[model samples]
Structures are given as structure tokens and as C-alpha cells.
Target: MTETVEIARGPYRAQLLALGATLRRLEVPDREGRVANVVLGCRDLDDYRRVARYYGATVGRYANRIGGARFMLDGREYRLPANDGPNNLHSGAPGFDQRDWALEDADASSARFGLTSPDGENGFPGTLRVEALYRMEEDGLAITLSAQTDAPTVLNLTNHAYFNLGGEASGRTILDHVLRIAGSHITPVDADLIPTGALRPVANSPFDFRTPKPVGRDIAQDDTQLVRGLGYDHNWAIDAPGRAATLYDPESGRVLDLHSTKPGLQLYSGNHLADGPPGTSGGTYAARAGLCLEPQLFPDSPNRPEFPSARLDPGERYEHRLAFRFRTAGSVDEAFG
Candidate 1:
């Protein structure tokens, strides 16, 4: 049976749904103690059916792209579906984000979803078993992803949560929010936004966030990657081990701290957001209204040797953790300070 885990923190209430093992909603308080849903999500399963972009969903098998939808495994070429132009994005034509996962366990603070992918399901040569655990604590939300393959294969899992700290309907762009990543180099992408197998320094470029900077500070600059993605959608190589990146909203005095064990973090400023129908809060989503910080292996990592490996073999368990902690600041105190 499907289950829902509801966890509460002050005025904030979060519901972890086991449908796809997704963190469905994260309601947090705004400036006036009024709670608003900050994460972008679909209200029902039908909404996800119409839009397969995996909003607030857990993506797996491979979270990003695989070059040309083909990869060499054990000296043999495995061809996958070319879903994203000429590359295989987020696994293939039909990834695991939309599949109904089994609820393995659930509690007041945590819930686990498990799924097994048969061999050759997406042209991957292995029987992959994966689990996604969502745990909400008084401090924040913690997501732990683990997977094991019966044979050799590639795996990269991440959550696609679009966050707007000022509330979804606050009618403000994330440009004013200050962001700081714990890395100096970023994987440059090609014209199609696929990694070009080069780790370039973020110095003197819009990718640089060594210090706290607003996302819109250099987003519109004449940068090739920015031009390709239309904004910040490339992965930044996180140099420090077990470090956390932070985004602070000065207006609401809310801080979102992202801690992860992954080597790279993809900072996507929702440049393509548009007002279609109304959203959860009956607000129209405009461009740059939200941002995503997906912590995982770099995009097209299987095709890039210099990047961290995404290969999973027998007797090996792939494990990674990401935490999003929220802290409130008093009216007189600085949010970032």
C-alpha cells in the first residue's frame, strides 16, 4: 500500500510521498509567519503525466546525461535512447523518476522507497536495485540514496527540487538571493549543454561563486555555457569533501544549507519557468523564480574520464547523502551573518 510520512517543524510542514519516493512538498514560513510551499511540484499524478520533467521527484539509473546515448561497457558498446537531442538525458526516454516505487518503510521522520530495474530496461546491462530515503528532522531534510547493480553499470541519483525561499508566490526572482558554492572549477558544457570533458576555473566568469554572490550578478554575461543553457545549469565541481553550499534569502531571513558527499553540484536557475496553469499556491511561475542545487556526479560523467567515476559493479553499494537545513534569522540579525 502507498504511504505518506508527514513531518512538522514549527509552522513548516513537509509530506514525503512514496508514489515515486518523492518529497512532495516542503511548506515553510515566510516573513509574516505565513507558511508557503517553497518547492516546485505537481499537485497530482496526472500533472506529472502531462509533464515528465520530474518536478520534486527522485531521478535515477543516471541522473544526468550520457554522451550520444551510448557507452562502452566491458569493451562492448551499449546503445541507449537518445532522448535529449543526441545525448541520453536522465537515463533514457523513460527514466525511473516516473515509476511507482514500493514503500519499504515509513515513519514520522523518514520514509524509504525501493525499486528494481530489470536488465536491459534502459539499455543498461544489469539488474539494478535502488532505494531512496527521505528523512525530515527539526533541523532540515536529509536524503540518502543507495543502489546496487548485479552486473557492471553506471548510476547517478539526485532529487530535482526547485526551491524558492521567498515562497513560491512571493513574485520575486532568485537573483537577489546570495549563493556560495564550495568549489572553484566547473565542467564546461557544449552547445547542447553536455559536458565537454574539461574542468575550467570559475574565475572571471559567471560560474564563479567562491564568495557569496547573487545568482543574477553575471547570469546574462556573454559566456558560452550560459548561452548554451540560457542560464546557470552546468555542474560546479565541489572540491571540498563533505562540505556544504549555502543560499541565503535576505528578504525573508531564510537560509538553505545544502550538504552533500557528491563531487559536483548542478545549480540551475529556473530560466525556462513560465506561467502555464496555476501552481500549488495558485501563483504563476515566471522565469528565474526558483533555483535548483542538485548534488551528484557531473553530467556525462561516464563519457568523461577525468571526472569522478559513475560505474557500479557487483558486491559494491553506491551510497550518497544530501541534507537541506533551514534556519530562521531574527529581524535585527543578518541572514548571512
Candidate 2:
């Protein structure tokens, strides 16, 4: 059985599920004060089970991909189940996203879901305990993912929630949404979508989002990286740790400011978000219907020595905080000014 938890503050609200500790729904008021669900989600638990797209789900013991479905940790090579072609995605098949988390605690304004992955689970070598806390604060929603392990392990967790500021079921694409990422370099990927271990400059490429631009502006450019991922599916090695990215929908006047503690941000333009599963708008979610600003560690970080370490040892804790602030363009201007 799946349990639902609702949290709201002011004009912002969110609904969470026990399964995958998923964020099933998020409603916020637009410029005209009309509240609508802005995140893509299935109509029911059965639908969620059918759609493995990871909509609003909390992903992984190691989010993103692990090259060759294997990594060397403390000199021991551990192999994981290859789910995404030749790489391991979101830590294999039945990862944290597929597990049922326990509702450890909840209140009117906050909820905490916990999950424990036994040692050797998904080929990871640790008895990891994770907690996802969703708190409705001020004008935004804060999500803190923290974990501890009894043994040394590599962990990279993040929420895989797609956003469409115009509202999820509006039958609209996010191509027109304006976006800004706080990184000057992106970890370019190979044909297999795994990082190439090189921090390529975002300048002179369609991947640049430094000054804020429409997501579709140069998306159709004849760039090799664009052809590789099919769209913006690579990770940006963020400039700093604070605010990572910003997204705004002109039509709705809704703005989303993403602040994170992580070192990397992935700008996924919903390149493959098509087919199957009816959305909240009672229609099939089309390609590019939503986009994900996933704040996480660089993909394939376990194998990249130059990247920040994702290793967690006994008595140590791994914590990642992502704050999504929602407001209207007018309000944003006032706040900034």
C-alpha cells in the first residue's frame, strides 16, 4: 500500500508518496493566482508502476549513471546491474526509486521518509540508511537527502522531479522556458551518455545557459554534443555551491530558483519524456513536456578521479540540500530589486 503525505505553506503545496519517497504532486500559484500542478506525475500508483520514467521519484544509492555498470571502491571492483545500455542507471533495476520507503515522521508542514538498503543490495557494499525530508518553508520547498552507511560506499542521491511551470497537464512543452545554469563548464558525455572526464567550456556551444535563454534557442543546432544526448542531458560542474540554476515560464509568469549544496547540476530538457502513461492533465505527456534541474554530483563520478569524491565511510554522513523557490516574475523582480 502506498501512503500519501501533503504539505503546504502559503500558496505552495506538495504531495509525496511512500513508494520511492516520490513527489507525486506540487501546486503553486501563477501570476494570476491560479494554482496548478507544475510537476509531471502519474494519475495513480498503478500508473506510476507502469511508467518507469522516474517522474518525481527520489533516485538512487548513486543517482545518474555508473560507466560499464562497475566501479572500483577501495581497490575492490564491484559490478552493478546494467539498466541503461552498458551503464548502470540510478543504481540498477530495483534501486531506491523502486523501493517502498517508510513514513518515519510527518506533520502539516513537513514529512520524512526513510529507507534502508542492506549490504550487497544492488551490488553496493554497505548497509545504507537514507532519509528524505520535505519541508514547506517560506516561499519554497526544501528537500534534504541525507544518508549514513555502516561500510564504505559511493553514494549520489537526488530527486528526479520534472517541472513545467505552465502546469504539467497543460499539453505544453518546456522549449520556451527561460533557464540559467551557474556553470561555465559541463562534463561532456560520450555516445553512451557517460561523462568523458573532461570539463568542456559551455561557451560557443548550445549548452551555455549562463545568461539565461530559452531552452529551445539553440537546441536544434548542429552540435555533436546535442546529437549525443538527443538534447541537454549532460551535467554541469557548477561554479559554486549556492544557487545552481533558475527556470522561468513566461506564459505563466512562474519562476523557479533552484539552490543546492551539490557541486553539479544536470539540465535535462525532457529529451526522452514521451509515450505511455497519462499525466494529471488527462493526456499523454509528450516529448519535452517538462524538464529536470537535477542538482547532483557529476555522472560517473565514481570512476573520475579528478571529480569530487562521492565516497562515504563508516561514521560519516552524506547530505545534499536542494531548495526550490517558487514565485511569479513580478515577485521575483521585487525580491531581487
Off by over 4 Å in 2: 330-337
Shift in Å, residue 246, candidate 1? 0.5
Per-residue lDDT of candidate 1, residues 36-129 (tens digit): 7778766554655466656677887888788889888778898888988998888864678767788888766677889998999889889999
Off by over 4 Å in 1: 1-4, 9-12, 30-33, 275-277, 330-333
Best by lDDT: 2
Pairs clashing within candidate 2: none
- TM-scores of the candidates are 0.94, 0.97
lDDT of 2 by residue, 1-337 (tens): 5889999988889999999999989999999999999999887677766667888989999999999999999899999999899999999768888888999999989999999999999999999999999999988799999999999999999999999999987888999988888899999889999999999999988988887888999998999899998888989989999989888888898888899999999888898878868886678888899999999999999999999899999999899999889888764344233
The per-candidate count of clashes, in order, stands at 0, 0
Residue 333 lDDT in candidate 2: 44
State residue 29's C-alpha deviation in candidate 2, in Å.
0.5
Give me the candidate number with maximum TM-score: 2
Instruction: Give the TM-score (vs. native) of candidate 2.
Output: 0.97
